[model samples]
Structure formats: C-alpha cells, structure tokens
Target chain A: MEQLLQQLVNGITVGSVYALVALGYTMVYGILRLINFAHGEMFMLGSYFALTLIVSTRVGVLQLVPNVLLGLLLVFLFSMGLVSTVGVVVERVAYRPLRRSTRLAPIVSALGASLFIQNAVMLTYGTQYQVFPEGLLPTTVWRVFGVEVTLMRVIVLAISLGLMAALYAFVQKTPLGTAIRATALDHDAARLMGIDVDRIILTVFLIGPALGAAGGIMVGLYYRQINFTMGWTYGLKAFTAAIMGGIGNIPGAMVGGLLLGILETLGAGYISTGWKDAFAFVILIAILILRPTGLLGERVAEKT
Target chain B: MSRSRGIALFLLAIMIVGVGGCAQPKAEEKKPAAPAEPIKIGVQGPISGQWAFEGEGIARAVNLVAEQVNEKGGVLGRKIQVIQGDDKSDPKESALVAQKMVAEKVIAVVGSYASSLTEPASAIYDEAGIVHITPSSTATKLTTKGYKRFFRTCFLDDRQGLFAAEYFSKKGYKNLAVIHDNTTYAKGLAEWTKKYLEERGVKVVFFDAITPGEKDFTPTLTKVKAANPDAIYFTGYFPEGGLLCKQAKELKIQALFSGGNAVNNPEFVKIAGLDAAKGAIVTTEPLPGDLPYPEAKQFMEDYKKKYGDYPKSIWVILAADAMRLIVTAMEKTGSAEPAKIAEYLHTQVKDFPGISGPIIGFDEKGDRLGTIHKAYVVDDRGEFVPAP
Candidate 1:
C-alpha cells in the first residue's frame, strides 16, 4: 500500500508537467485546428531560457534577487515571454502562409517547424545534456500517510494545478475565452460576428506556448537536466495525453495527461520497467481502437 | 569498297587502344614515389552529439599523436595525415562514417566510442579490407565475430564485470541491486556482473533496466528501494547514471551507489550535483589524470600543452595509443600496405608501450591484452580517486 501510494505521488508529479505541455497541444488544436508540433520545442527553449537566466547570468547579473521565490518567478516570466513570442512568430511564419491550403499543408509545416526549432537549438546549444543547477530550493521531504514527497514536487504540482485551474476558470467565465471557443467552432461565422479570428488564433498560440514553457521550467527544476531533443519525447507523450483526453477539449487534456502519467508510473512500478515506454503506446493504441473520439468527445471538430 | 574501309577503321582503332594500354603503366611509373605523399589515417567517432565530449577527447588524442609523430619525422617518408569522421555516437551515422573512411582510402581507422556503434562500423571497415581498431568499445562479440582485422584497446565486458563483482564482494556488499539502460554495453556489463555475483553466492535482490534519455527514474528507484539491497550497481552512461544517483539520493535509499566504466566522466559529477555524487563508487580503467606508466604521463603532459586540459576520459588515451599502435605497425613494416600491417600486428606487435598501460598486445582475436580496471570513488573535491 505504501509503495502504491509513493508510485501515485510519482505519477502525479510527472503528470502535471505533461498536463502543462498537453494544454499547449489542446489549445492549438482547439482554435486553429493545427497541431503545433513546434510547441514541444517552445517548452524546451523555455527551460533553456530559464537555465540561462538563472545559471548563466542570474537575471542581469544580479546575484541576489531579494528572495529565491521572486527570482524563480522572474525567470519563469522572462522565459515564458521569450518562448511565447517564438510561438507567435512560428504561427505567423509556418502556419499563416498555409492556412488557406489543404489541411495536410499545416501538418507538414508543423513537422518542419518542429525539426527546425529542434536543430536550431541543437546547433546553438550543442548536442549534450545541459545540467540544471541543483539546491536552488530546499530539500524538504514530507511523509504523508507513509508516502514521501519532496518540497520541489509539491511546489511544481501546486503551481501546475493552480495554472490549470486558472486556465479552466478563464475559459469558463471570460468573454475572451468565449471568443476563442466561437472562433474555434466556425472561423468565418466568428469573423462575421466581429471576433478578429486571426488575433484570437494568435492569442491561442501565445498562451499555449507560455504554458508549455512553464512546464519546461518545472521539468528543469525537477529533473536538473535539459537537452535539445528532450522536447520530442515529452511532446509526443503530451500529444498522447491530449489525444487520449480529446485533442480539442480543454479539461480533457488535463485529465488525459494526469491519467497517462499515473498509468505509466504504476505500470513501470508493478509491471516491467523495460516496457514502461511501451505501456504509454499500448494505452494509446487501445484508446484509438476503442474510443476514436477520445475520453472527452470533441465538440464538432469536423469542418463543413 | 565500304567493307575494306570498315576493316581499315577496325585496325586503326586496335593500334590506338594498344598504344593507350601500353602508355598507362608508363604514366603510373612517371609518378613513382611522388615526394611528400601523405599517409591518410581515418579517425571515426561521435564528434557532435550526446557523446561529443568523448568524441572531442578521441579526436584531439589522435591528432596530438599525429603531431608528435610528424615532429619527429615523416613515417616512411610521408607525413601522417589524420582524417576525422564524425559518427555522432549513432549506429546509423557510424556506418556512413565507415563508408566515408573507405572512400577516403585510409589504411587503418581508430574509432567509434560505443559498443553498439562500433559493431556496425567495424563490419563495414572489415568488409572493405581496412583494419578497424576501437579504443573504448568493450562488447566481447566484437572480437568473436571472426573479423581478421578488427581489434580494440579496451578490456571486455566480462573482465570488467568480474572485477566489479569481486570488488563489491571485497567491500562486503553481499546484497545488491543491478540496473542497466538496455544498451549493448550496459546490458552486457550488467549480465556479466550478475553472473559473476551469482557464482559467488551473492544475492541479487533487485534487477532491472531503465529506458535511456528519459529523465525520470523514480519509478525504478522506488522499486529497488523496496527490494532493500546493501548496494546498487548501475551499468549505463553518465547522463542517465547521474540522474539515477540524484534520484536515489532523494529517495533516501541508503545502499552504496556504484557504476560501471561508462559512468566515469566529469559530466556525471556535474549532472548528479556535489551532494549526490560524493562518495559514489565508479569502476573504470586508469584515468588519464592518475596513470602510473611513463607513456601515459608524457601523453598527459603533451595533451595539456596542446589543448590546455586533461583528456575527458581514459578512452581518449586509449584512442591515442590505438593511433600509436597502427603507426607502429606501419613504421615497423616500412610499408603502408594493409596486408603486411595486419600480418605484422597478428604475428608480432607484442610487449608494446601504450599510453593507458605499460604493456599492450593483440591476441589472435585482436583483443588488447594486459588491460586492467580499477575501482574509484568520487572524493570530496570531485576527483575520481582510487578507492583504498
């Protein structure tokens, strides 16, 4: 029972980051109906930016940021800002030109953008695992019901869950969120209703990458290692989460990400560790076979 | 009249062809022993990927050796030219590098860092009748494949594993957990260690392999903690090894953490952090910084003078020694012919001085003899000091 509880904690800790990246996939697919393959690189670049800010220069070479939490917040904001801008640029350059063409054009463009960003980072940063500085935060551990959890895990989970809640609330209540949904439903009708569909799509690209970047930062803090190609695996897994939960649905991304994370953890813990990666794809295959529309059925994704 | 004209044209064509054929050999004779003809030696390895540091170490080592040899005099009246082939430490890229080496017509190649990569590459070089020698690849079957010219400068997995198992027993760690990343090198080491430990009646409480390149290893570590071994032995490269060390420390698993030779890198310490890396045991050959041989010290001094830092690992020194071995065979034979060099290496080339060790030789299997592994522990200063 204790082992099971610990595995669950591990699952949730890993899942939240996937959820964060999955939000990018879900949002991009929701509005533009374009799977932003480059979104994962945005997450990777986010980590790189944060690593540079903290380790390389430490926020304009000021060693003391008054408090570590404030310093971390500053790094997060800066990296997310940079990556979100990159995301918007990617949309304008890669997707905007081909929006009028066949749907396959954007998909191919997304893949090209993905490879371009990955190789760009590789060439710039060099192909090696960049180690994140450890001990930025304290190593406090808590034993709740005989399951040990660290301070970093708690912080990451709290921040990611908090971000997901804020996003869910905004999508439920805000007029901007409704505009996004309307534009996603019917771009022409939404434009006729004065929604500025292009701006809405830009907003989607911006916010999605911002969340993915935050996830990247969290992963760096937790794992203490970042590389250029890491985004691909994380992105593929997060894409699986988005697909499992329904690619175009918001809450579905969250649920699917968490569920996959837990399933992978428990599977590795109880079953064979060698098949850990195989477990994710096995579930994906089963989901595709059983429920092709995903856990939360997408709302009229078909284009007329 | 047309038939007579056709017969005359055929006769004229035969006379011109005969003259051209006769002139070809005289043209080759005209360039006999062209002054300053360079000896091209192919150096293949991962020069730009996850293992780029290792590749750079190898490349610099071979070049330093070449520069030193050239400074003395040209080998057989020709400058020793080093041609580099970057494999990116990938198997697919390795085959391409081998093809490049073949196309460049290098007499011999000293290359490829990992076992899986070296396997594919050696096959290509062997097929093309080129002598392929690896400095770091330790998989046993590399020599067992019956390739006449394939050789390695490192000890095999079983030998290294046997030494590790014996070392653990000497330290009184009877109960152990063995882990690997399922790569050819790591898995082979793990299997050998497990076999040797079982032979000595040591209980392997836990055994598993983790997927490489993925960061999170807590799931596997959690399971190992449940098994509650006296020690944990990780057989994998540094990137994942560092993470395992860090995560295991975080989990508060008190088993003595140890690793195989692939984990003997400064990057391992950097990635694992000071707190997690201190006192960790690593089984490896004599590192460049702490060698007892005269050739090794000279090479280290030369390396520092040339590059301003010590080579990344002992494998770098071995790579340099591989270059020396190939050059030695070429120099003693006084010929650049591959067949003579291969025959000389097979029959003679024993009791040689290597940078990694005092004595180096190749057996019938082309495996380097007299190489030994030492167990080291990371000291408080992050140095891989020999364990007492």
Candidate 2:
C-alpha cells in the first residue's frame, strides 16, 4: 500500500509536467489546428537557456547575488521569456507562412522545425548529457501520509498546478481569452467580428511555450540532468496526453495528462516496467475504439 | 533544329570532359606508388550522436596507433592509413558504413561502440570476408552468429554478468532484482545474471526493462522497492544507470545497486552524484590504470599526451589494441590481404602483446581467448576503484 501510494505521488508529479507541456499542444491545436510538433523542442530549449543563465551567473557579475532562490527566479523568467519568443518565431516562420497552403504543410514544417531545433542545440551544446547544476534545488525528501516525496517533486507539482490554475482562470474570465475562444470556434467569424485572429493565435503560441518552458525548468531542477534529446520522450507523452484529453480541450488535457501518468506508473509498478509506454498507447487505442471523439471532445455536425 | 543539335553536342562534350577530369586524378595518384602501397583500415562507429563520445574516443586511439606504427618504419614497410566511417549510432547507418568500408577495400575494420550497431555491421563484414574487430560491444549473441570474421576485445555480456552474479551471491545477497534497457547488450547481461543467480539458488525477486531514453524511473524503482530485494542489478548505459541509482536512493531503497561496464565512467558519478553513486558496483574490463602491466601504463601516458585528455573509458585502449593487433597480423602474414590477415588472426597469433593487454588470439567463435573482467565500486571521492 505504501508502494502504491509512493508511485501515485511519483505519477502525479510526472503527470503535472506532462499536463504543463500538453497545454501547449492543446492551445496551439485549439487556435491554429496545427500539431506544433516543435513545441517539445521549445521545452528543451527552455532548460538549456536556464542552464546557460545559471552557469553564466555562477562566476561573473551575477555572482554578487548570493540568494539562490532569487537567482533561480531570474533564470526562470529569462528562459521562459526567450523560449516564448522562440515559440512565436516558430509559428511566424513555419506555421504562419503555410497557414493557407495546406494543413499537411504546417504539420510537416513543424517536424522539420523540431529536427532543426534539436540539431541546433546539439551543435551548440555538444551531444553529451549535461548534469543540471546541483545545489540549485533542495534534495530533501519529505514524508507525507507515510509516503516519501522529494522537495523538488512538491515544487514541481505546485508550480505546474499554479500555472494551470492561472491559465484556466485567464481563459475563462478574460476578454483576450474570449477572443481566442472565438477565433478557435470560427476563424472567419472571429476576424469578421473585428477580433485580431492572428494576434490571438500568436498569444496562444506565446502562452503555451512559456508554460512548457516553466515545466522544462522544473524538470531540470527536479531531475538534475538535461540533454538535447530529453524533449522527444516528454513531447511524445504530452502529445499523447493532448489526444487523450480531446486535442483542443484545455481542462481535458490536464485531467488526461494526470490520468495517463497515473495509469502508466501503476502499470509499470504492478505489471511490468517494459510495458509502461505500451500502457499509454493501449489506453489511447481503447479510448479511440470506444469513443471516436475523446472524453471531452465535442461533436461537430458535417455540412452537406 | 540545327541550333538545338549544337547545344546538345556542347553539353555532351562537357559531360565527357567532366568524367575524364575526375578519372585522370585517380590514375595519376595511383601511378606514384612505386613502393608498397599503404594498407587501408576502416574505423566505423557513431561519431555524432548520444554515443558519439565513445566513437570519437576510439577513433582518436586508432589514429594514435597508426601514427606510432608509421613512426616505427610502418607496418610491413608500408604506411597504415585509417579511414573512418561515422555510424551515427543507428543500425541502418552502421550497415551503410560497413558497405563503405567494403568498397574502400579495407583489409580490416575496427569499430562500432554498441552491440546493436555492431551486430548488423558484422554480417556485412562476414559476407565480404573482411576481419571485423569490435572494441567495446559485449553482447553474447554477436559471436553466436558464427561469423568467422567477427571478433571483439571486450568480454561477452554473459561472462561479466556471471562474474557479477557470483560476486553478489558470495556476498550473501539471496534475493535480487534485474533491470535492463531492453537493448541486446543490456537484456543479454540481465538474462545471463538472472539465469546464473537462479542456478545458484538465489531468487530473482523482480525483473524489469525500461525504455532507453525515459528520464523518470520512479515508477519502476517503486516496483523494485516493493520487491525488497537484497541487491538490484541494472544492465544499461551510464546515463540511465546513474538516474536509477539516484532515484533508488531518493526512495530510500536500501538494496545494493550494481551494473555492468556501462556504469564504469566519470560521467556516471557526475550524473548520479557522489552520495547516491557511492558503493555502486560495476563489472568492467580492467582499466589500464588498474592493470599492473607496465606497457598499459605507458599507453595511458601516450594517449593523454596525444589526445590532450586522459582516456575516459576502456574503449580507447581496446580500440588502439584492435588496430595494433590487425597490423601485427598483417606483418606476420607478410601481406595486407583480408583473407591472409583473417587467417593469421584466427590461428597463428597467440598471446600477441598489445597496449590494453595481450591478445591470446581468438576462440572458434571469434571471442577473445582470455579477457579479464573486474568489479569496481564508486568510492566517496567519486572515482571508480577496485571493489574489495
């Protein structure tokens, strides 16, 4: 029972990261209906950016700031800000130009962008796996409800949930959120109603990548390791989470991400670790077979 | 019509000139070989991916050997030329590299760091009747293919796995868990360890495999914790191995964590951190520094001076020794022909001294006759030292 509870905590912690990244997929697909495969690379770049900031500050001008938390916050902000710009540029260069050409064009372009970004990072950083700077985050393991949990895990879970809650409130209560919703519903109608559909789309790209960057920074701190290819596995899992939650549904992505994480962890813990990844795909297949549309997906009537 | 015909003629003339221009340089270059032609040896391995460090390290050692051989009046009075083929750590690319080496007519090939990459390339070399020596790939199935041309300097997974299992059992570890990355090498070692442990009346309480690049192993570690084994054997590369150790310690799993040669590197300690990595035992081919051979010590110094960095892994010495072995075979046979060199390596060469150690020739299966394997544990100082 303790083991089960322990895995549950681990699953939820990992699931929150998936949810954070899944939001980026759901948001982009919501507005642009493009998969934005390169979003995962944005998450990877965020960690690299934070790594550069932290390492660069360790010996130079920023070393005067002895407060680790303050330095970490600055690094996080700079990384998220830069990664958000990269997300916007990716959309503008790859997706925006092929907006009307064909749906397949942007999807293919996104894949190309992902490869380009991964290789670019590899060339710049060298291909070796880098150890994320140690002592940045406390490695204290806390006992909660008779289950062992790390301080890093709690921080990751809290930050991810806080970001998700903020995003939910912003989408539900704000005018810009309504414009995004309007644009997602009907691009032509949103533009006709004087909504800047392009700007709304750009805003979605920015918010999604920023959240992903946050998740990236948290993963680096929690795991204490980062590499160029780390994004591929995380991205694939997050993309699966998006699909499971209904591609364009925000809250659904969150629930789906957590569910997938829990199921995978439990399956790995109880059944076989080798089949952990297979469990996610099995659930996906079962879901697709049982309900053609996802759990929260809406049925759109076909026009004759 | 006349103007179009003239344009076609002009284009055809340019094509002929282009074809002739390329052929003339090749003929001219070959004409100057009045003496013995340089022996060509192809070095194939991943040069630009996750495992690029291993490949690059091995390639540097191979070049170093070639330079030293040339300095010693060349092998058989002919300069040794090393040609490199980058496998990119992919099986398909490895086969392509093998084909390129065949096309280059290399007398022998040294290479391919991982077992997965080496397996497919071995088939290509075997069919071409070229001698192929792998410096680091340790999968037992590699030799099981019965390919006469294939050989490896490193001990097979079964040998190392048996050594580890025996050590654990002798240390009174009754129940153990086995984990692998599902690669040929990892799985083979895990399976061998499990079989040997079971045979010794030791219970393998838990067995699992994790995806290669997955960062989060808490779920898997949680399961291993539940099993409550006395020891945990992880058969995978250093990156995942280090992560597993860190997570296992974080979970407060008190079981001893051990692995194969993949965990025998400074990077492993760096990733796992000193506290978590301490006492993590790894079964590996004895490092040159650890070996008592004076020549091994000299080779280490020479490697550092040439590469500007100490050899990080045993693959460096293994690669250099492989090249030296091939050149020695060529000199003994008085020819660089693949068939002659293969014959000499398979039969005549017995206890040939090289930098890493002595090559006691090869078995019928092309496995090295006698490869020493040792167990090392990460000390508190973050260095891998011989386990007491």
Candidate 3:
C-alpha cells in the first residue's frame, strides 16, 4: 500500500510535466490547426537557457543574488521569456509563410524546424549529456501521508498544477482567452467577428511555449541532467497526451496528461517496466478504437 | 564519306594514345618521389549523440596514436591517416558507416563503440573482408558469430558479469536487484550476472529492464525498493545509471548501488550529484590513472594535454590500444593488407603490452585471450577511485 502511494506520488509529479508540455501541443493544434512539432524543441531550449543563466549567475554574480530561491525564479522567468520569443519566431518563420499552402506543407515545415533546432543545439552546445547544477533546490525527502517524497517532487507537482490552474483562469476570464476560444471554434468566423485571428494565434503560441519551458525547467531541476535529444521523448509523450485528451481540447489535455503519466508509472511499477512505453501507446490505441474523439472530447459535426 | 569517318577515328585513337603515354611517366615519377600513400585506418563510432563523449575519446586516442607514429617518421614509411565515420550510436547508422569505410578502402577499422552498434557494423566489415577492432563493445555474441576479422579490447559480457557476481557475493550482498536497459550489451550483462549470482546461492530479489533514454526511473526504483534488496545492480549507460542513483537515494533505499562499465564515467558522478554518487560502485577496467604502468601514466598526461580532460573512461585506453595493436600487426607483417594483418595478429601477437593492459591477442573464436575487470567506487571527491 505504501509502495502504491509512493508510485502515485511519482506518477503525479511526472504527470504534471507531461500535462504542461501537452498544453503546448493542444493549444497550438487548437489555434493554428498545425501540430507544431517543434514545440518540444522549445522546451529543450528553455532548459538549456535556464542552465546557462543559472550557471553563469552562480559563477559571476552570486553575491548580488539574495537567495537561491530568488535566483532560481529569475532564471526561470528569463528562460520562459526567451523561449516564448523563440516560439513566436518559429511560428512566424516556419508556419506563417505556409499558412495557405497544402496542409502537408506546414507539418513538414514543423518537422524541419524541429530537426534544425535539434542540430543547432547539438552543434552549439555539443551532443554529450550535460549535468544540471545540483544544490540549487532543496534535496530533503519529506514523509507525507506515509509516503516518501522529495522536496523537488513536491515543488514540481505544486508549481505545475498551480501554473495549469493559472492558465485555466487566464483562458476562461480574459478577453484574449475568449478570442482564442473563438478562433479555435472557427478561424474564418473568428476573423469575420473582428477578432485578430493571427494575433490570437500568436498569443496561443506564446502561452504554450512558456508553459512548456516551465516544464523543461522543472525536468532539469528534477532530473539534474539534460540532453538535446530529451525533447523527442518528452515531446512524443506530450503529443500522445494531447491526442488522447482530444487534440484541440484544453481541459482534456490536462486530464489526458495526468492519466497517461499515472498509467505509465503504475504499469512500470506493477507489470513490466520494459513495456512502460508500450502501455502509453496501448492506451492511446484503445482510446482511439473505443472513442475516436477521446474521453473528454465532444463529438462535433464535420462541415464538409 | 567512309574514308573521312576512318580518318577521324584514327585521329581520336592517336590522341588517346598520346595522353596515356604522357600520364604513365608522370604517375611513375610521382610514385617514386612522394612518400608511400598513407594507410587509411577507419574510425567509426557515435560522434554525436548520448554516447558522443565516448566516441570523441576513441577518436582522440586514435588520433593521438597516429600523431605519435607519424612524428617518428611514419609507420613503415607511410603516414597513418585516420578516416572518421560518425555512426551516431544507431545500428543502421553503424552499417552505413561500415559501408562508407569499405568504400574508403581502409585496411582496418577502429570502433563502433556500443555492442548494439558494433554487432551489425562488424557484419558489414566481415563480409567486405576488412579487419574490425572494437575498443569497448563487450557483447559475448559478437565474437561467437564466426566473424574471424572481428576483435575487441574489452572483456566480454560473461566475464564482466561473472566478476561482478563474484565480487558482490563475496562481499555478502546476497539479496540483490538487477536492472538493465534492454539493449544488447545491457541485457546480456544483466542476464549473465543474474545467472552467476543465482549459481552462487545469492537470491535475486528483483530483476527488471528499463528503456534506454527514459530519464525517469523512480517507478522502477520504487518497485525495487519494495523488493527490499541489499544491493541494486544496473547494467546500462551512464545517463540512466546516474539518474537511477539519484532517484534511488531520494527514495531512501539503503541498498548499495552498483553498475557495469557503461556507468564508469565522469558524467555519472556529475548527473548523480556529489553526495548521491558517493559510494556508488562500477565494475570496469582500471583507468590509466589507476594502472601502475608507466606508459599508462604518460598516456593520461598526454591525453589531458591534448583533450583538456582526463580520458572519459577506460574505454579511451582500449581505443588507443586497438590502434596500437593494428599498427603492430601491420608492422610485423610488413603489409597493410587486411587478411595478412589478421593472420599476423592471430599467430604471433602474445601478451602485447598496451596502455590499457597487456592484450593476449585473440583466442580461436577471435575474442581477446584474457580480460579482467576492476571495481571502482565513487569517492567523496567525485572521482571513480579503486574500491578497497
């Protein structure tokens, strides 16, 4: 029972990051109707950016920083800000130009962008796995409800859930959120309704990557290591979560990500860890066969 | 019209004959005046991926040996030219690289570091009638495939596994949990280790396989925790190895953590953090620093000077030794031909001293005659020091 509880904590902590990255995939799919395959690279770049800021500041300007927590926050904000710009630039350069072309064009462009970013980082930072600086975060393990949990795990879970909630409120309460929802409903109709559809699309891109970057930072802190190719694994999982939750559904992505994470953890814990990845795909296939629209996805009439 | 066409054909033949006559003397003149064409030695490995550091170490060591040979007025009056083929650590890529090396007309190839990469690439080399030497690939099946040309400097999986099992059992860590990445090398090592451990009357409390490149191992570690073992043995590369150590420590698992040679790297310590990595044991060949050989000490210093870091792992020494062995075979045979060099290596080389250790040439199955492994523990200084 304790082991089950421990696995649950592990699952939720990992699930939150997947949920964060899934938001990026679902949001972009919602607004642009493009998969934005390069969104994962933005997450990778965020971690690298955070690594650079933290390492440089710790070495050069440690005295100016009041505490490690404040320094971490500053690095997090800077990395997210930088990755948001990267997301917008990727959209403008890779996707915007092919907006009216064949649907294949933008998807292919997204893939090309992903490869370009991966190679660029490889050429610049090298291909070796880099160790994220340790001791920045507390390493204490807490006994919570008869389960052992590290401070980092608790922090990752709390921050990720908190960010998701904040994003939910922003999308539901703000005028920009309404514009985003309207665009997702019908792009042409949203444009006719005097919404800056392009601007709204760009805003979604910005928000999604920012959230993804936050996930990246959390992963780096949690794992204490990062590699260029890490984006592929996490991205694939997040993309799967989005598809499983309903590709363009916001709240559904959150539910899907957490469910996938918990299922994978439990599968690894109980069944066979070798087939942990296989479980995620099996669930995806079962969900697709059972309900093509996903569990939380609403059936919509196709406009031919 | 027929007379004119005959005259044009005769004129073209005369022009071709004139060009051939001029090229013959020029080629002859260039051959004698210039040094013998450099022998092309191919180096294939993952130059860009998770294993890039190991590949770089191999490449650098090969280059270092070549530089030393060339500086001493070349090998057999011909400079050694190292042709690099970056396999990117994939089996398909490894085969492509092997084909490229064959096309490049290399007499002998140095690497394809990981066992999964080497197994396929070695097939290509064997079919192409080229000698292939691996510095780090340790899968037992690599030699058993009847590939006469394939040779490796590292110990086989069985040997490493037996050594680890003996060491742990003698240390009284009877209940153990074994984990692997499910790759050719990792699974082979894990299986052999488990078999030997069971034979020694040690109880394997838990055994599992994890996917490579999966960053998180908490779920699996948590399961292992429930098994309540005295030690956890992970047979995989350093990336996951380090993460497992860190996560296992976080779970407050009191079991000692140990792994195979793949975890014998500085990156493991770096990723696992200093505190978490301490006392983490790895079974591998002794590093150059740990070896008492004077040549090993020199190699370490020269390597640091050249690469700005100590060798990433003992694999670098193995890589350098592979190059030296090939060169020695070439020199002894007085031929750079692949078959002749292989024959000389098999028949004549005996207990050849190398920076890594004394290599006893090849057995009938083309495996190294004898190989040994040493255990190292992560010290408080974040270095892999010889375990007491």
Ten-residue segment with the worst summed lDDT in candidate 2 chain B? B16-25
The segments of candidate 1 whose C-alpha lies over 4 angstroms from its true place after superposition are A56-64, A298-301, B1-142, B145-150, B294-355, B358-362
Per-residue lDDT of model 1, residues B1-388, tens digit only: 9769755754544454344334434433443368576888889989998889998899899999999989988788789999999998777777767767766667789988988779877877776667788998877788888998888888887878898989988888889999999998899999999999988888899889999888889989999989999899999999999999988888888998899988988889988888889999999887688887888888888999999987868889889988998898888998776667788888887678788776456789988776478899999987789988
Q: Rate the local accuracy (lDDT) of all candidates.
A: 0.86, 0.85, 0.86
Q: What class would a CAPRI assessor give candidate 1's docking?
A: medium
Q: Which 10 successive residues of model 1 chain B have the least lDDT summed?
A: B23-32
- For model 2, name the residue pairs that clash: none
lDDT of 3 by residue, B323-387 (tens): 99999888887767778888877788788888877877788777777656889999989998899
Per-candidate Cα RMSD to the true structure, in Å, reads 7.9, 7.4, 8.4
- Provide per-model DockQ scores: 0.60, 0.66, 0.66
Expressed between 0 and 1, the share of native interface contacts present in candidate 2 is 0.84
Indicate the worst ten consecutive residues by lDDT in candidate 3 chain B.
Answer: B20-29
Top DockQ hit: 3
Provide the DockQ value for model 3. Answer: 0.66
Q: Candidate 2 on A72-168: residue-level lDDT in tens?
A: 8888889999999999999988888898787899999999999999999999999988787666666899888878899888888998999999999
The reply for model 3, stretches above 4 Å from the true place, is A59-61, B1-142, B145-153, B292-362
